[model samples]
Target: MTTTTRTIPFKADHVGSLLRPERLHKARKQFNRREIKAVDLRKVENEEIKRVVDRQIEIGLDVVTDGEFRRTWFHLDFMEHFNGIEGYVPKKGYQFADGVETERYDVRNTGKITFNSKHPFLKDFKELNEIVDGRAVAKQTIPSPNQFFNAGIQNEDIYPDIEDFAQDVIKAYQEAIQAFYDAGVRYLQLDDVYIAGLSAPDIPFNDGKYTREYLIDLALRVVNGSLENKPEDLYVTTHLCRGNYRSTWAFSGGYDIIAPTLLANEKVDGFFLEYDDERSGGFEPLKHIPKDGPKVVLGLVTSKSGELEDRDEVFRRVHEASAYVPLAQLCLSPQCGFASTHHGNELTEEEQWNKLKYVVELSKELWG
Candidate 1:
């Protein structure tokens, strides 16, 4: 196995989505309500996203993203592109930790899941690549195969066999990955928050039909399968998170339960793990990361609130984690995206920028 350093093994990175600027948010709302033409909305999104990309470059980030400006929710927007999937609102919304809930909806697959050439996010990545112009690398983030698994079986009648259903999901993701690579993407991240959720003590994760261990094995299989046949130059990373919705979380726990399976066996270039607060538990679980395994991106800063963390404290925590995993196999980022959804967290735009600036500065101080 190759343990050599890879190109995408950068010192600093991010979870991708940024808080939508008020102007872009307004345009999206207007377009959704049919108050403006799609062309006009694109004009606004294009302008704002250009600024977001520019800021990423200007702030000295290793990879730049479109800030996921095209959609309302990070995962659903991409999932909706699959052939038979659709979302519908129920009487309740998505519930997060701290008893916080929002007007979120559930997605369902009316038919088979497959990648479409006209996938909007793929198109979005293409546009961002053009804007990047080599000043910085362009990165793309997609929901993990486990995301489909955790969303529950909306199409069980069509895919009664669990293995068969997972294979289809794997095929869809593999196609999506290749399409992304064909679009000039050398670095891609699969956001696999569900894996972290499974580690939470509060989460039972088991219904009488499927045990938690069974589901986890299936998730790992699906993730690795989707990564099969990837190009040599492609750098694939997985970001694990408990949850993030408007400064509230959904679960709490460390990477202990999954470290052995996810950190040790997963076929990826790196892991962007959340370790910002007590809820994430201790870094002891990091021991499961093999000596020559994929690099670890330590999320030492919290993205839920705008409040800045002390630089010394953050550095201290970074070193603390190095005890379990070598410092050479580490990177730095926020606990999660500042805005997993367009609504964004409770932080202001200024605070968000400051958080990123801290990451850039900290990365240079330690890794440079």
Candidate 2:
């Protein structure tokens, strides 16, 4: 691959969510037990979010998020706010690696899904925007439209045809993208585990109704459709990981199976891909990424553990990936968020900050 001198933005990026602080976690539990009011809970969330945002800027990151402090699950908190979707507790939890199962909280499609004009997250973003005050790019992260297909319970009575369900999800996300842009958000990210799951050799919950290719095509359609007519200046991206709950992953595979379509055709500004361990497979599939396509943020450092990665090894891997895509098109980040859920990964908050500090330092040494 040829190299270019073009400068990539957010060279040291992250997959959005950060570990929830102990105070925030305690506040959430108190609120859950009716010991505190919703407003009181929000006050705690705001304080913690501000603290995290300040740390992100102080660490030399140009982009910052609310650290997903007000959320329980990184995706569900945002997804449940959509019209016709309601949060519920399921009997069974999601089984992660090493016998770790997620909590029973999940969302279900109760009726026709549509974007809620008064979506709570808009207010959430607005608060973060005010706190940021242009100090750094305020990024809003939500679950991908495709996530509805796999993560949510569809009401067959309300939507007998799966295609119809997909269309509603597409439209809802389209409105959501526009909504965030209107809410003073310049950078937005979609956290998608569904697409990554589809890359697996044998999909776990495949009912044999839809082929893998069909699902992949649908994912492209949903994601690209959501970006339709998005503001020219709005920076949108997607982060894909097999699964990240309490440091245990749900699937194992590479980008090879879906790269030709996902990496090449997704209408986004960048892609944050998981590549922290052998389970993510090789970088050969990155060759499918077009020269002029989205910038690839390689997640070479592991967020699941507190152990720091070998700096030289990370540098070498970046060069190896550049064999497929140009050096100028590549960026650096953790394999995934330090926390995809409020429970977080197997690391302390101090370790999380160190990991991000490592990324920022490494990017300067490599890209500067």
Candidate 3:
């Protein structure tokens, strides 16, 4: 594998949406009631994802995500694609301390060895490459290792021991990553908001069982354990979001808590950090980042709303962050995707494309 690094001064993010149409809602309702089979729903997802990828390239996006179009929620939807994984829908629903309620049923992994019948990621990437007219990077997003750990503990019937469960989860993830690499995808991003929430005093890792240092060690092990001996040219990264659902947030804390680990220890090519507001705190903590490795993508714009970001202000923050990491080692994008899940956030599809246009415009003016 070549260790060649390319810097074309392009800007992009981790993952994107699947552009679900209103018909999906009606179809999903049918699926929920047993009126339609899961196979048909998958077909809808494929068609929508194709449109999403085409639109992204037409808008001049440097990298395109399948738009997570087929997913109900990012993490669980992907986990459900695996065998032995089932959703545990609660009667009243588990409540976020932030007062937000999630309709998603918690996910659990069964120990039985069952792989995905067909890798959706492989099919989508292949389709995207065929249809897009120009050269654009292709990416696939999966939940972080910590996400799998959390999912395993969501229900008790699947696995009695969380540690053993984590082992199984890690094995499964390693397999999934390898499969994506084999399918010709070079960029893989692990979507993780769990670390950001852990920085808060309210909810801690493993239910507050570990301190910040311990949690960092655990996070490193989980991420790096699965990453061991992979293809060198395959670039893996992580995108951190406070939370984005219907324009509502789920956590509030600065990078101060996770700076040491997030900057120095976490293994990945770049970090997609949310710096859209004060919720992300100051940039001083970024100084802890090791100078020798990984690019840092400055997430200075907001995808929560359609309002365009002040380009000047975005540039200001970018330079401020550059105080630690060099500008050449940096890139820019929204704090998170417009629709982290299939709900598509509170903004319209037009707004999403406009926001991306701003990223491209700003990146060109600043970096060019």
Candidate 4:
């Protein structure tokens, strides 16, 4: 296997979010019920974040994140902080496999979407950076601009044309990139479900208003637009997953549909792709990835379950993918974050750590 010394996209990397500890879960509930003040909740969150950060470093990870410990849902929390967006209970929750439905909470546009200069996540990263204090690379994750389209443009009156709405989103994300870069985040990840969702034949995207290809192209435009002025030193990547809620998934398909466009054109440092099972299809599409372009961090391990993956299987798959992209351009990670939401997957906290530790060990065996 090809080996190299790179810190940003480590051989053993993870998509940011980690499972929330029981105490933090309790603290959130208490704060929601008004049983404790916001300050009290913040204190609990701070303590939990520090502990998780330490655990990540202890497990031999080169990069660490806040584990998204402060939020309930991964994307909604970050989106709602943007101006002109508000959270509300949707008429129905997202339908996952086996008829499993997610929580009803979702975000919508109220007027015009703009990045809040004082976005809470800036402070969140600042606190995380202070805690890390050069011990490890502190990576920050947020939703991709394409997610807003998946959320749907609720107020068409404010944005009569879809193109206009898309432009504003691109601008908002551009500001967000700058904001985070200013806040001292050198590594950033944009968690994306929408672009990958287009590949799932199960979902009827755009409702006949646009073809799958059209939507995919539009999504790529927004993503690339957001990165237009991103600082060269700020390493940005995207994590694409089908869905993660209570150990269930919403869509099932292959990268074959979106691979040519997404893998070939999307401008980013790397792509954290979901390839845990057959649902994501074969690695043939990876051939479209440019040889010298972004590194492909293969998500060969599953995060939804507690059982460990066979080490040999993972190694075989890594080499298999190298047939399309060189082994030197490959890395390993879980298909997605252990906990994309506060509810998390079915795995226990101990199992989650074990899963990550396994990734580290596998990296050492393969690359070192």
Higher-scoring candidate on TM-score, 3 or 4: 4
| TM-score versus the correct structure, for each prediction | 0.96, 0.96, 0.87, 0.97
Error of 2 at 357 (Å): 0.5
Over 1-368, each residue of candidate 3 has an lDDT whose tens digit, in order, gives: 22122532235543455335677777788888999999887677666667777777777677777776666787777776677777677565435435867675777655453457485656766665555434577777778877765523434565665556556667777887788887776778888877777676556555565466676666677788778766888888888777777677887788887778766778788878888888788888778777857778877878878899887888888898889888777888888877766666777778878888788888888777
Q: Across residues 178-292, which tens digit of lDDT does each residue of candidate 2 receive?
A: 8888998778888889999989986754567778888899999989888887888888888998899988999898989899999989988889999999988999999988897
lDDT of 2: 0.88
lDDT of 4 by residue, 1-368 (tens): 11222456788999988999999989989998999999999999999999998999899998899999998888999999999899889889888899998888888889888999999999999999999888888899999898898746457879878889999999999999999999998899999999899888877775777788888899889999999999888888988989999889888999888888988999988999999999999999999999988999999989999999998999999999999999988999999998898899999999999999999999999889
Lowest lDDT 10-mer window, candidate 1? 1-10
- CA error at residue 229 for candidate 1, angstroms: 1.2
lDDT of 1 by residue, 244-358 (tens): 8888888788888877787889999899999888888898988988897788999998898888899899889889989999988888999899888888999998899889988
Best by TM-score: 4
The global C-alpha lDDT for each of the candidates, from Candidate 1 onward, is 0.84, 0.88, 0.71, 0.90
Q: How far is candidate 2 from the true structure (C-alpha RMSD, Å)?
A: 3.3
TM-score between model 3 and native: 0.87
